[model samples]
Target: MSASTHWLATASIQSVLERGGNAFDAAVAGAFVLHVVEPHLNGPGGDMTGIFATADRPGEPVVLMGQGPAPAAATTEHYRAEGLELVPGAGALASAVPGAVDAWLLLLRDHGTWPLADVLAYAVGYARQGHQILPRVRDTIATVAELFTDHWPSSAAHWMPDGEVPGDDALLRNEPYAAVLDQLVGAAEGTAGGPDPTGTAAGRRTAGIEAARDLWARLVGREAEAFLARPHRHSSGTDHAGVLSAADVEGFRACYEPSATVSFRGHTIAKTGPWGQGPALLLTLAILEGFDDEYLDPSTELGAHTILEAQKLAIADRESYFGDTDVPLGHLLSTEYSAERRRLITESASHEFRPGTVPGHPPFIPPLRVDYTPPAAATGAKTGFAGIGEPTVQPDGETRGDTCHLDVVDRWGNMVSATPSGGWLQSSPLVPALGFCLGTRLQMTWLEDGAPSTLTPGKRPRTTLTPTLVLKDGQAVSALGSPGGDQQDQWQLLYLLRTIVGGYSPQQAIDAPALHTTSIPGSFWPRTWTPGGAVVEDRLGQEVIAGLEARGHVVTRAGDWALGRLSAVVRDPATGQLAAAANPRGVQGYAAGR
Candidate 1:
């Protein structure tokens, strides 16, 4: 299938527009389509993060932080108080107010060229009609189904789309779901439907043409469901976080605003933005400036060695020092890049150390902690570096996690990058319906009883879902992103350095094998894979690995044929040619351009 077949790529977005959807509409449409195509990663049950720059807002870009924050009923004390070690389960506590709807409404309000009902028409249709399950989808279902094993119907339902998870190419359909979408997205625009898609702003009213406007406006509505209901089959409702009196759709924070931005090497970025990590990128860039780029890109031994060292040092500092800049982790130092941080990084890289994971562990986690936490700092800077890191989710279990990354650029010199993710349930499985797969992202936190990232009411867990963009003269040159958990930034940095800076074409950079270094201590979750250099199908061969190993690299094998699928788009300055490439590791990770 063509990459444009999905919506995030501008080719596909433009296709939707040709079929009568605007950028906002196309994004929403693409997301819905993606749910049909790659339900294992995201769906109506999950959330969305979108960055759409309208020609109208040429100067100020629009960013929608669509990902959900912790639910109101969740409390840090609740998890710690339960004596539950590690992450929580996927019960009522794991979910957040469905942010996709709110973000969708916000985007519809601003840049939507068509009616929300119209944009959702395709998604709802696909949900009901069903899409075929590709190898990737089946792989995800087969691997991840076990994590949801305890959740009953959800586990059984999600995997058995076409009689016991079809092998390879299986025809899949969500008829029951399609009916539901028809009802939800088909709600009247105004007077007739129960929902008041209004009050947020005048624009969201979606005031369709006079005749059908009132009808469509009031078409559909959402009533909160029980926190731990059977399982959601569609975008239903969430009863008040704790228990009874149901909360209405209106209670969700539906307003959209610009994201907090940081600049790195002259490029603007957003932390917790269209995807998380605007500051981290800036911090990494700052650290890189202190070194020689050409020297850093030497032998598989010297090159990967330098990056590994730098990756460990910078990532370690982020774990301790990073937090919501507004919330201020007074105990931790500032995440801003500084000469002190650079100096500390240089000093710390000369030695080796493994940061400890949460609870210190029985196997003792070996400091191979996950990297999705807020910005952090290594303890007192005692030289933290290791040859290992996985950034795994329920590792050694053969479990699979779902995630999506897509970048879009309009002909108008505007670009957008967004990554959407949710882990297994909080710590357990709790599916309310069949239509949506609830995210257990809360489990990503350390859950150390009183720790901040733990089960805090209405708080968003930290994530390493970073999106990378390059802008020159305030115009976008390229937008790049991946879905490899913590390794995302690591692989992305390499890609950016070689492709954007070293001047490799988009396709060439994408074809290049990727590497990762988990050499830093995770703030919360356990780190799984080690970092060094990864060869695609032995593409660059053993010589590279041997050289890397000699440099103290673990050189783990990513044998999955397709590993860490990366998608990127590049804009050539002189030619104005728009080129895109999908990493070879992923069958579906192909890029299309017009």
Candidate 2:
């Protein structure tokens, strides 16, 4: 079973399944295809985080942490000298080490059934032959046409074949990316000596996959080193040079770690470590666990208020304590601490940024920049969608980002949820030979000293790309995730609440109206805060809105289906049953199962 935000991706997963591949193989195929079909949301040069549970391990979930860290040269003093208050959301200078490809390949090598070349074939075919362009992709390209033409000519050359954006539904091809994939396939085949005829298939395939990984690392390292050596115009409206070297790319590798988990209502929810924003959702859930079931029903006015207030408190702690370094998670997730934090949520919306105090470690609050200006083209200019790159940092001082998610479950009860993001077509100048742009994930780091998320050499950015896995009765049950940046966890919480509390199915849970609070400081560039800000789907009804407004919440009505793009897959260990569901808001997501 597979569910993703695109039919093509779902089909790719189905293709893998039909070929007798396992859940991990199907997920890898779907993710690679997403890089082809959803370039505006994610790309080969991005990063990802995955949570998976294998049949052998049962309820023990592991985190595939592919989030790359800053290069050794990236530092607060260096960016300060360049006159940057906050990192530029879209530029080479904002790039971390690229890790998505390696992470996916690693997962496939260990858990998947298909050979490396076989799993990558779907993406290669889409990039070479062609695929229909989504309207959103066309619009995103149009929004950054000026940025491409004036500053990043390489991007204009790559994205615009004839010096113009392609029409919607046009068959789009990235030949250069196809060539890159083809070369990787060749490397794997040469190293593995074709298909394995003996019983040593697993061992031989793993060796071949390692060879392909080395080839890819060397190729990308060379390209990135050469590209960053030259000065380029950044979103900061200044010519800046990157300090990342080929060594940085070659030395970096994605790793696996034990997942951080929290239990509620008899189900254990597992998430990425504190390095990413996954723990914030767990914190929110812990706080909500203190409330009554009536107060937890998000469809009701009382529930929405309670949810929003809990989110604010959790996200505030996210800004203060979570990062690549060791965080005092034990105390924060304790029952006593959650009860203390829950007490802060009263009858009204909170306008202050408040993080809880831990026993040993005091909360470290970064310097908050309430008023900051990002360097976009003039407001009077004719940019169709201002601030289009990564969808991070709204022109209205709000911050958001886009990503791609895929969830899969095989007959063997193996399950995975992955969220890939960062390298968008609009992220940076295209690498002419690579047919993709470098990711700008480093922008998530703070420039202020002493903050947990502060910019440091070789430190992972506190990424917003988080995926979730849940286990019940010591067995893997479900995997789910969404695409919004800061709202990824927030939107997912509503789904979890409805599913666990109201006993809703995956589809019904995702189809329901959603809301997320922006009352805390945003994690993206410019790092602006919106006190008492809450964006809700208008379909949530007038009474809910009025109640929230009456409580002094500043509410913005996003159209009914405009908010979340979540997808999920569930497995029944007892009966060997599998079910899947995807978001319908964009008319692109699909779910496929037998």
Candidate of highest lDDT: 2
Instruction: Give the 10-residue window scoring lowest on summed lDDT in candidate 1.
Output: 381-390
Compute the lDDT of residue 406 as modeled in candidate 1: 70
Residue 107, model 2: lDDT of: 96
After superposing candidate 2 on the true structure, give the runs of residues whose Cα lies further than 4 Å from its correct spot.
194-199, 375-401
Q: All candidates' TM-scores?
A: 0.77, 0.96
Candidate 1 structure quality by residue, lDDT tens digits, 135-213: 6567655644433343335545555643365677566666644554555444435423333456433333454322132
Q: Rate the local accuracy (lDDT) of all candidates.
A: 0.49, 0.87
Q: What TM-score does candidate 1 get on C-alpha atoms?
A: 0.77
Q: How close is candidate 2 to the true structure, as a TM-score?
A: 0.96
* Tens digits of lDDT, candidate 2, 150-224: 878988987887899988768889999999999888888886886665648676788788888898889998997
Tell how far residue 189 is off in model 2, in angstroms.
0.9
Give the per-residue Cα lDDT of candidate 1 at 315: 58
